[model samples]
Target: MTMNKIYSWQHKLWNKLTHHADSGANALLLKGRAGIGKLDFARHFAKFRLCETPSSTSEACGTCLSCGWFEKGGHPDFYHVSPETSANFSGEAAVAVDRDESAGRIKSKKKTSQQISIVQIRALSDFVYMTGHQRGRRIILICPAEAMNAAAANALLKKLEEPPAHVLFILVAHRPQQLPATIRSRCQLINMPMPDVVQATRWLKQQGVNEPEACLAAASFAPLLALTFNDQRYAAQHDAFIEQISASRKINPIELAEKMQQSDLPIVVSWMQKWCYDLLCFCLTGKVRYHLSRMTTIRVLASSIENKALAAFLRTLLVSQQLARHPLNPRLFLEEIFIKYATLLDSNGVKRSS
Candidate 1:
């Protein structure tokens, strides 16, 4: 349960932030792409602010009483807000409740919510308005802030509009645009930095990742996500999915959909999106961004794919991505997308095996 330490790429921003630690801005927004460690950065900054004695470099002293409480997840003055179903800060996978059939009785389990609720926001009033530990500064961190529903966002807006004394709000968002304009306006927005390929690849290597470059590219250059690519199970799934999709003439949409229905829908959609993106990219620029290991296959696929149809399918994938999070029938949802893709290839004269 160690605290999230600052990464090498964050040194410059860290110094600038710590230098302006008391700039009188009650609310700060750390907006960036996912897997760039925005949440970790926010957590580290919060720990530092609450530390009784920070280091010369403006980092939290790990041995301080405040740091101990923060690390133990019992800091009285610090509150973390995220979706009920999110494992955003815990560095774990969120598990969905499964139905139980025991004692010859069927029990239905309620699905965990993926959106922050108004109740969660209202509950923050007590912590925000109350005195801090030893009357020191208090911090409220909301991660993936866009998860707040409309009502919850409105409740939080009231606090940001008239923030209490000695309280700071740190919002980490992967898609800040999803947040309301007023909420964005109330905070001092900072676009979190992204590491270059060289820096990212170096860090991944230090993490003992094999084929770091390929993993990095597969994650669209997001280094943290590249770590997941190192997982053999996940890597195998991605490779198999890509192989089936690449051979459009041999794809069995229904069977593929059935096999993938048990997997994370949004993630599967993202995988397809990346593969199709490479195909489209190859068609247009004589290059492939992702699927570098399958360049020969991508080149052949790109040659037969109609640019207009491929582009249209890519747009369709965007809508699919949005609906993926809460699909009523996962199999049907995937089937529809895969069927469309098969039809697209068929229209391009990709004949199926007899």
Candidate 2:
């Protein structure tokens, strides 16, 4: 609940939610794009519902015992379930923040796993049947609900099938399609509101972000993502990647792949996918969605790569993204993709000087 500050655009939804503070809905699923504040809204709503001395509008008073415990990250009646890799989880497994030196000490001991394991779901079953320490509503918040694997989702489904009195389940899903149909059907769905371009821009400026428009485009209009987009190093690396890939005739596939070996594979692949998407878009209609700032370069590159070859490379990128999550040799993986990309423009293996 500590990081549940709502954005300006969510005012309407917030007002609507206040009306249903005491509703009998056992489960509420908030689904939307990543960085649109669905999880934060859930946390805020949960805190408001559990406050012993809530205001007339049902907002947390912040001075009550419940508010204090929740802020300190030890509210007995409150439970947060997410992927092990998610930093929102509490206790020794909490994700470390860079602001504190000691935070890394514990986090370095173990790499956080990505899936919300079946063990976590099973544990929730026991907690659901148990009494709330404060005789209040027990709130269980599952963030990025799609992180649950088949076994974990099945275990969670059992709890949803048998509702416990005085208990509430709040599931926040960024990609609801990834969730099982049965699990999604059991919850009352709330689609998180998407901010208009003007509102998102204003919010980004308020967060002190430079080049707000460009950042928003990069994040696909996710305002929260635009706010946190301050990685200068990654921007430089991406620019270099674009340059290399655009001038495929002169670039050395092996050398470029080796340079990117130490970089984040998933992000690199994501950027490549976006780049390909823009190329395809340009090939079809001379329009670019993601790399607006590089329109001229994209236009030039789009004309060079075969439309059919570009389509096939997009599929390769999708496969690479899935494989990037698992253990694999970075150099070899990157090399293979780069080699395949090189073949698209130069099947003769001829290296032209820039």
Best by lDDT: 1
lDDT of each model, Cα atoms only? 0.78, 0.73
Please provide, for model 2 over 1-64, each residue's C-alpha lDDT reduced to its tens digit, 9 standing for 90 to 100.
1364677778888888888766678999998876676766777787788888888865789989
Question: Per-residue CA lDDT of candidate 1, range 1-354, in tens?
Answer: 123678888889999999999999999999986667777788889889999999897889999899888777778888877765322332222101100000001111235454688988898888877888855699888866877888989999999988899999998887788789999999999988889999999999998999999998998888777877887877877788888888868989999998887676667887889989998999999888878889899888787778899999999998897666557887899999999998888777743332
How does each model score on TM-score? 0.86, 0.82
Top-TM-score structure, candidate number: 1
- What is the lDDT, from 0 to 100, of the residue 79 in candidate 2? 85
Q: Give the TM-score of candidate 1.
A: 0.86
Please report the TM-score between candidate 2 and the true structure: 0.82
List clashing residue pairs in candidate 1: none
What lDDT score goes with residue 113 in model 2?
Answer: 50
